[model samples]
Target: MRKTFLHIKIIFCSLVVFSSLAQSASFDCSKASSDVEKKICNTPSLSKLDEQLSEVFKPLKKQRTFQVLESEWLENVRNTCESVECLEDAYNEQIGFLSPLPLPGASASNEVKILPADKIYAQSSRPWKTVELAGLPNGKDVVERFLISAEVISGILHVVAFEGHYDVPNSIYRGSLYEYIDRHPIVQPITYTIAKDIGFQGAFNLGNNEEGERYAGIMGGTFYYREKIARNQLRGMAYKVGSGTQPQETSLLLQQWSNTFENAKSGLLFQGDEVFGELKAYYPNTPGYETIAPVDRPEVGWNIFSPIWSKSRPVLYFKNGDETIWRANVVDKTLTKIVSASDQLVIKNPTPVDLNGREAVVYLEDYILKIAVAPE
Candidate 1:
């Protein structure tokens, strides 16, 4: 796993500064000159300390465990006391009877594998086949579906992969199913917990009818089971895996090229001036679409093609008339167009498409070149 301690530490420091100075005189901790003095000044609030510890210790709680040995131990035991013969039969004939024997081999202990000190049990399953896309700019490629097993460790669900496969060049690529599981969130479970009752406990009933036995629940209710709950949660923990839910007008289009990509929603690339002087609307489903500015920027030099969720940045697909060039974001979201000769460049009239949920903007540096415009 990539060490994110430095990043976390930086965030921690920033929060400390914001809380101390940005609020009021009562919240100020600027009086302390040294780190030791600051610690002394902040030590009075044990409750605050407890809350902070709880916040940080949640992931640790999932990691800690206790062991128990299985044993056949019962507090109380009882058996039928005595047997009596019928009064009438005893009087008539000599009463004769044989004793019954007690059953044996029922004193064994049950064994179970306990969870390790640093994990919680969760299950995930995916499709059986890999969906391949042919003629994907560079070449034809295959992407596979996957199931993952994950556990919360250090406040993050680290995906300890055991299986998966991908169709690469000539051979199949398989192994280490969730290589980046440590970074992504367990969105659905966390969201469900927040939206619904976190402490609520319940069960499932299949039903008593014969038809119900075949299905989970039909006309009647059957067996009961408890729902699983997870702790150590984060805010805004929603799942977003595809681009279909988002509007198409934004420069960032969700490209599902690799399973490793973090926020698969904003890596789309079109023309440099794709949204040049056009009216666009933000997609409601997008997290920060409302904050997008309609104002334009320089199209030349460096332009951010997509949002940077993490280290993995967007790749650029640039075309000046019939000439086309492709380059990956080497430094964050900043794009530097590379110059090249136009050869087997494919240019067709862009079917007047609607920007469903997102708006577009044309940068100042890029000249508004028409789709039919050719270089002299």
Candidate 2:
């Protein structure tokens, strides 16, 4: 396993205000990994302290156990904090301790490293994966999801993450925020993640949900995503990722290449933006079509160049939640259910010639649905 080490030493800022200098620490900005290291490098005050700490650590380096103590201080005191200010305070506290800071957190006990004081202090900003949950507007889902794990005081949906479904790690948590845009159903996809450090737990206020029910603990630092959301909405993703019942399949990858949404009463069929393949659909049985925007293109008027035959007959298909498919028939312009959602089904758009025979369906990931009449 790899290890990281740092020892903070406080220096009189006045002495370095006007002196030509070199780095006092072993590491420089070029070597820093965590966000905290970057902050120390960028800020003049923190840089001076880091350099001073390096100088102090040099003399102590001759001592057998000094390096060990420095390592302990890093894990227990420094890594726990999430902000520059918090880190600065941690350094000052360490400065008051013996040589490399007493064992754990600057405690008066001679027994260092033996206590449970070793805790991560601060950290740099973390990278997060964006998960889009659609149709959830009121922020209720977010509350419900995290209510048990963390204390959700509830203002615009605030939470302190408790160990959740082992799937989400401690280093990560949902940092959340919400707002209305373009008034299109106010489908504000609240950006959120579980906070790892205490530094991110602020910018809070009492706010209300879609129902106007007031909540508490809504914090700041989640505004970077609004522009992206706005851009998506403009491009026709009316049903955005929200805190609601999202799609079972997260495969609707947004691409400028070629994806098409066909809204026939039979259902909402979506062809993956493939210049050549992959079809998906949300049938009439699936709710929330009213939530999607319409296209000027004629419905069911698309031309099908190829027809996938189940044996001389073109097939029309519908997806049953990510898995399973259904064979469908259009009666009086409405889809009548034939075969239910199943596996190994293949379907493609019905060609003008095959429209009179039988209508069926197949579409989803990895395979192209071909529905052209077989050669006579």
Candidate 3:
């Protein structure tokens, strides 16, 4: 009887140990075949970190850019971990990258207020207004779509529109490039014949060169292809327009081939060989280029994209994350958060405009174009 009781107690203890290991990790410990997977199952602290990382990665899995980053991390960082300590460190780093950081110096007094789409034009004390463009010349009704880019040059508004349905599969973003003079339309189709299946992926920029000649530029390809190209790769072209001259095409080399707005001294800003490399500037009229921001020291957040130039100053605005707009003064090396949405909103294409002598910003919110006037 004593022997039988000892046998029963040993079996019960073994079962408890098995159950703990099975339920600890985010993945099933029973099917854990890899060395790293086995280490995570056996270690309690590492298993907890794995669970935390899984939760943080859930919402961002659908993003293609994030997906690529995650895959690289798994192959380069997580899978190469040889010990439990290395695995723990890798998991922590990934979780931090996926999570949102606290907004720097966020306060109510300095935050820019955004009006509702329906009540944009309504009388209010808030400095918000919706962009009202006249009907297209082709008699087509102007629908509320995604504003890819917008700029005000010489008191004229140039805008590029997309289909606004980013979630849909294989939805081609073919729309007209319009020029609005004082809210009236002189719309023309800037036809994108190259890669018609994929459409444009980046912002449509309109700026002037050193000789005061105006030009228009945009990236033509899929997002993935553009993102993976090297610095020396030929990305797109810029067409020299206006000034009573014929449209002359100039090949734009490297990535981010758009011209930076600096009045009569506009130039090209692009990255180096590295994906997150040093920011370099090249003037069309100058002999050589200069470095604006080095790789070791980034002036602004690396994730900021869709640059909209300020006509009055040597400043450029970018959209950070999904809801914050950051203004970067390249000359002064200062980055300021100009706008922060109160809720979960995708604020896109922050364009600067002079509204009757009032400095204001125009951007897309839920497929509608809205403007926010700068505080005096």
Candidate 4:
């Protein structure tokens, strides 16, 4: 998540040694006179305050002092959960059980902390989809609700797609098992043809066109998707949200036939019990688009929420597709999720970034939107 200047100040205080009384017992809410004061004294509120204070004083609390880099653990969690949820339903029937899987290194007491050096949040497992050049029995070649990585060929993007396979008797699904390679149109001569003079050496943009119908310039090109949208493009490729920015992204193309391209533009999410709706473009200035006033949707109220924001990107940009809720970045050259949403639309492009454990997923349906990962 984006580290506010206030957070930096808090970090500074965390590094120093304070008085014993300063670190003593908390206030008693039962004896508080005011509701606000009493609320602050309550268990959850008190705990939050303590955590906030501790975070601010982290630098001082630790014996070894080091640099504090911003991370987006919340964004990571939200995007990961959303993306996995997209396919969770379908995969649930295919798999044998129905329970949330624990993240790597997750324990009862210890929570995953976001570090600056962490390029991605999670890793890919076995038993994924297959990528191939020729058509399979289904003949569609492209499979929905999955993750894959491809390299740039002689000016083309080549990715190996695979369906996750379960080992019989063992009852374990080999995670992210390689399937086959699928190739789509790419710019001939690749990056060299576009900018021969510039020294740009990076992976080929094997992204889907997400924001092609609306939100002009918001999403485009694999490079733009990777840099601007980041992991949200995975959902875009999956066709969870919308395709306002680019259509080449995976998800957007999937939704093209449905013609409900602006699914991610504005929507609501029910997490546990709370409901959140996007408000970034609630009142749009552009013509041809109807403005959704808060009064019209009192449930959303005036405080329309956006996805979590990180140093790199926003979470809302990655829209939810039919089977993929939020296709996000597990790390470089890899993606992860549990499929479920057969009708959910996803915008291609618009990805997420990790900022101090705050996770954000961006999805551009008619407009760029996001969803934040709730605290553990």
* Top TM-score hit: 3
Q: How many residue pairs clash in each candidate?
A: 10, 42, 0, 127
Per-residue lDDT over 254-370 for candidate 1, one digit per residue giving the tens place of the 0 to 100 score: 212122123222323222433332111122233322111113422332222222121122222222333322222222223322333234443211111001111111111111111
Residue-level lDDT of model 4, residues 308-340, one tens digit each, is 212232123223222243332211212233222
Output the lDDT of residue 252, model 2: 25
* Rank ordering of all candidates by TM-score, starting from the highest: 3, 4, 2, 1
The TM-score between candidate 3 and the true structure equals: 0.37
Where does model 1 exceed 4 Å of error? 1-43, 46-156, 159-376
lDDT assessment of candidate 3:
0.49
- Candidate 4: residue 6 Cα off by (Å): 45
Whole-model alpha-carbon lDDT for candidate 4:
0.26
Worst 10 residues of 4 by lDDT: 62-71
Of candidates 4 and 1, the better by lDDT = 4
Candidate 4 residue-wise lDDT at 153: 25
Of 2 and 3, the candidate ahead on lDDT is 3
Better of 2 and 3 by TM-score: 3
**Regions of candidate 2 where Cα sits further than 4 Å from its true position:** 1-26, 99-376
Tens digits of lDDT, candidate 3, 1-376: 9999999999999999888788899888988999999999999999999899888777656433245456778888999999998998899878876664432232221122222223211111232323333332332433324444455444344444443223224332333333223321223333221222223334332211111222223223211112112333324433222222222224443243342443313343644221454434444444555544344443443443555566555556655555766655544445556676546766765767654344567666644445554443
